[model samples]
Structure formats: structure tokens, C-alpha cells
Target: DIDRKHIHIVSVRVDETGKKISDSFEKKRSDAIRKELEKKYSLLPAEKQRQPENLPLKRVDYKAGDVKKQVSNVAKVVMKSYRFQSLNEYRAVLSIYGVTVEEVKGEVRGKAYNGLVYSALDRKGEKVGNPFKASLIGKTAGYDALQKRIAFSKQSMKEKAVYNRSRNIISTLLANKPDRKVFEKELAKNGISVLFRENDDKRIYGVTFIDHQEKTVFNGSRLGKEFSANVFHELFNRNGRQDSSGIDYEKQFHINNQDYQPEQESTAEAIAGIFSMEQHGDDYEELAFTNRMKRRKKKRKGFGL
Candidate 1:
């Protein structure tokens, strides 16, 4: 406290080392860690920069204008074949069958008396011909005999009605087509058998006829390539041949190996099973055994066979 006014201090000095100890240690530690990482991972070294490979270029030559012109030409040709007339006036031909007539004899020489004639009616059941003339004829062959003959004739006519009607329909449909023979051939190819021809003077344009349980008619020309293609496709399909429908004839299943089997699988598997049985007898026997077991199980479960 007494020497406060004249207090003195001494400073201490240290010599500089080659590098700071802490800094040297940090540098060495960093290098050691880098070397350890390199030894453990062994990553690929950096490579020289390179240019990317060039890909081949392509060019389209189709011009929009040229495509439009070509499409227009095809459209014009197709349009020319289409009919534009009103369809309301289209007529079909139908045949009247089982038609029988009766005439009465006159008391005077060389003159036949006109009397009521009875004929079998159409599906509508309307009595055909004059009743009085029918009665006179009925008198000649008794009512029972006449009725029997009429019934037989009616049955025969009905049997032929489908065929007759189909012919009439086809003829009427082809009336304006101008390619009747071609159309007929096409229909025949499709299994349509023409029965009778219709009168041309009636100006009928379309006809309908019976094809077994089906009614088919030709009404107009095929609309386009697609329609023609479809017709041919159906024809070939039904005839067991390969048409342009992309169906492979060789791949289908069949009961007999000689028959056409399209490459498509059948839902019932009947054809495939039959074919397999024919080709692989042992496999077929095993399959049959399995099927029989399944049927027995189903029967036990109260399912209908």
C-alpha cells in the first residue's frame, strides 16, 4: 500500500516452435483419417471429362396434304357405291302356298257351274276361296276326304314355306343391286339355299325367307370393305376355314383330328378333350377318371347332373 505510486511489472517472452503443436497434430490426424478411409473403401479415382455419345437421328417423310388427298380419293369411290334413295318404298316378296281351288259341275252340257271353293288358309287362318265353290267340290269328294287332303297339302306347304320365302326375299333384295349372281354366290357360300324365284314384275326390292329357325334376307350392297370382310369372315368361320379374321385354323380343338380346329380354346372344352383323348390315350383316361370323380362329388352335393 505505501509503494502504490511507483509499482513496476516484468514481461515474460517465449521462443517460436517450427509449427504450432495443436495445428501440427490436427494436420497429421486429418491425413491419417483420409488414408484409412481410402484403404477401407477403395473408391474409383476421378477420370478425365469426356463428351457424350451421339444418337442416330430419324426423319418422317409423310406430308399432311398428300395424306389428305389420298384419303379423299378413297372416300369418293366408297360414296359412289352407297344408295341414297328412301327406304320406305322397299318391297319384299312372299309366296302363297297350299293353294287349292274347287269348281262345281253345271246341269247344262259342256258348262261347269261356278260354286264356292275352299282352300287352306295362311297363318292368319282366314278361309281362302269362295265357300259355295268349296262346298260343290266338297260334295264330289265328301267333306272328310277333302279336309284330309287339304290338311296334308297344308302341312307340305308349311314345310316348304321357309325355303320359298327366303328365295323371294333374296330375289327382291337383289332386284336393284345389279350383281345378283355375285350376291347369290355369296349367300350360298354362307349356307343359304335359294328355293324359288319371285315375280320380277312386282318391283319388289327386298325379300325375307326362312333358313330353318332363322330368317335371313339380302337388302342392299355391302357398305364397305369392313362389311365385305365381315361377310367373308363369317362364311369362312362357319365353313370351318381360316378367313381374314386373324383366327388360326390349326390351333382350334376338334372331335376328330382331320376336322378344322381354330387356334382358339372352346368354352366347353369338349373339342379339346376329344382331341386329347384321340392323341394321348393314357392322359385321356386319367382325365376321364378325374371328371367322373367330380361328377360323383357333385351328385352327392345334390347338384343337377
Candidate 2:
């Protein structure tokens, strides 16, 4: 219905008891996205256009308890700065900003819709207050916009080619049988944050890596199966004789050359067993024979023949 000066809109939600839900979802979502802009950008009532891209956005303070604005600021900065292909990957990065997002899909009054809900998290990783609809922020933070961003991020990550650097750092650490605390410390030193998602039984089910240097977030499996949660859990749980892939990370990727390498038998030894891991430290006689041969050569040279 239309009024003389303004139009009114109404909606409702009913609970299982057939009573109204009385949630103020619409009012909160309808709060203009321009509120943040006006407060920070000094926009006057006369300004019609949004801020330009060249202008920098003021970072929001998560401690201020402004969930909506905080979520919006984090989403904008992440969408512009980082490369993530999946919701989990995106959430891992947003989590650093004290925010999280969920994808929602359902039917209402015979209409089906898919959308995202944004929420703010506290220092302890608890939701602070009511969540906000994607619409409350803007199209930039909407579901569709994020899907496009994911695709573009995929391409951008490929072009950057920095994943290997992140991987080598992680693999080098894991290969040495480091504990969880040491693993995290080494990664942090290399500008990487690995978030492990675990369950009630303390079983690690998922993992995400955020590379601060490259500004990229990657799911564990996306990096490779070797970096998956299973690999990490096994490394910390089991004796760590071998990583999840059953390859000794230390020997396979021996970065420290001072570590001894097995002395080889004659070059004509069995070809099929070349990759064997056996090391022969009991060959004292062979070393003695080599020393004798060297001395014989020295004595021959001393003769000046």
C-alpha cells in the first residue's frame, strides 16, 4: 500500500507455535550502507555517489562492537586484497578480522533464494550479536559477487605463482617432524597462518592456510594432499616416523647437507634397489683401504719419479 508521502513495506516470520517471531531483521538490514561512508569519508547529505575506488577505506575497529560496519570493512578489504576460491578459504582470512560468513539457501513462500549472512566474532571466536544479511552491506559483499571473486581469485593466484614458496616452507618444516607449536611458529616466521579445524574428539578435520606475504588463502587439499589435516594430525599424533604419505620428510627433503648420506656400493650394484633407504656406517675397512690408497699415491709423488 502507498501513502500520501511514502511507501510502507511489511514482512513476517512464524514459529512452530504459530506465533510471530518478532525479529528485527528487516530494519537492521535496511540500515543504509552509507552510514560508514558518511562517518569516515565526510560525505554530506548532498553527495549522491559512493566513494571512488582510488580512495582508501578506513579500517574498522573490531573492539568497537559495530558488527555490521566491521563485517563490511573486512569483506571489502579481503575481496580486494586476498585470493580465495572457497567459502572456507575466504572465512579463514576474514577470521583474522574478527568476522565470518555463511552461505544460506532456502525457500520462502514458494520462492527459492540463495544468499550469504555475515557475522562478527569476538576475541574468543564467539559471535558477538545478531548476524546481518548480505544486502545490508552492499552488492560487493553479496553471494553472487563472492562467486565471481572466487573465480577471479583462482586466476590471480595462478599468475602469482607464490604457492610453491608457501608450500616449500611448510613441507620443509613438516619433513623434520616438528610438533604443533613448532609448526605454527615456523609458519608464522614465514608469514603464514595455518588454522586447523578440529572436532570434539580432537581429530583434525580441516585446515586452511593464510599467506600474509602473498595475500592468499588456500584450503589444505587445494595446496595438495600432503598439506591436508590428516598429514598434520599424523605428524603430531603418531611417532612421526613418516608423514601421512608414508615418505620420510627429513630424508626426502634433506635441506641440511651436513646430514650424512649413505655411502654407495660399487656403481655396478643392483639397479632396482638404488632408491633404498639403507645406510652402511659399519664400513670401517673400506675407509681404511681408501686411506691406504691415498697414502700410496702421496708416497709415489714424494719419490719425484
- Best of the candidates, lDDT: 2
Colliding residue pairs in candidate 2 = none
lDDT of 2 by residue, 204-242 (tens): 656778776676788677778898777876877786432
Q: Kindly give the number of clashing pairs for every candidate.
A: 18, 0
- Candidate 1 lDDT, tens digit per residue, 179-218? 3334433343233422221122211122222231132222
- Tell me the lDDT of model 1 at 15: 33
How does each model score on TM-score?
A: 0.16, 0.57
CA lDDT of 251 in candidate 2?
Answer: 27
Of candidate 1, the 10-residue stretch with the lowest lDDT total is: 272-281
lDDT of 1: 0.30
Best by TM-score: 2
